[model samples]
Target: MVDGKGKKMSKSAGNVMAPKKIIDQQGAEILRLWVASENYREDIRVSNEILKRLTESYRKIRNTFRYLLGNLNDFDPVKPIGYR
Candidate 1:
């Protein structure tokens, strides 16, 4: 979690982020983004509010990819398009 004040996230600082809560609320990608976006030198704060928002977006994306892959598995590209 970030104080949004340039402080570092650490257990000693009482700003440690929870993984289960983050995944449960933010899905995963957003949490991933937060990890990628933030500098390791500084601490990040991850409140439930942010987690919930990002999770919904992540869920939509996850479902879309699943649907596409599942549907594409039944395709038959070998049938000559013009002949069949």
Candidate 2:
């Protein structure tokens, strides 16, 4: 993985970002999304900006699902209402 500076993450450089630390800070979903969004064919870059953008995307997706689910909270399969 590379850092925001485009340099490889290394313990000697003090830029290592551990998965457990990221999960503890931003939640496992964020970490998982970050990993999923990266291109497996290339080196992944981890930075504050990338994480911030990913978090926003995650929120949008989750909020959309919540809205759709909320609209179905009172839905009944047996009752078919005519469109107004």
Q: Give the number of the best model, judged by TM-score.
A: 2
**Stretches > 4 Å off in candidate 2:** none
The TM-score obtained by model 1 is 0.51
| Candidate 1 Cα misplacement greater than 4 A, ranges | 4-15, 19-30, 37-45, 80-84
Per-residue C-alpha lDDT of model 2 across residues 1-84, encoded as one tens digit per residue? 898777999999889989888888788999999988889788889987888888999999999999999999999999988899
- Residues 1-84, candidate 1, lDDT per residue (tens digit)? 465454667788777667876677555678796666556774555665655655676679889999999998867889555655
Q: After superposition, how far is residue 51 of candidate 2 from its true place, in Å?
A: 0.9
Compared to the true structure, candidate 2 yields what TM-score? 0.88
Q: Rate the local accuracy (lDDT) of all candidates.
A: 0.68, 0.90
Judging by lDDT against the true structure, name the best candidate.
2
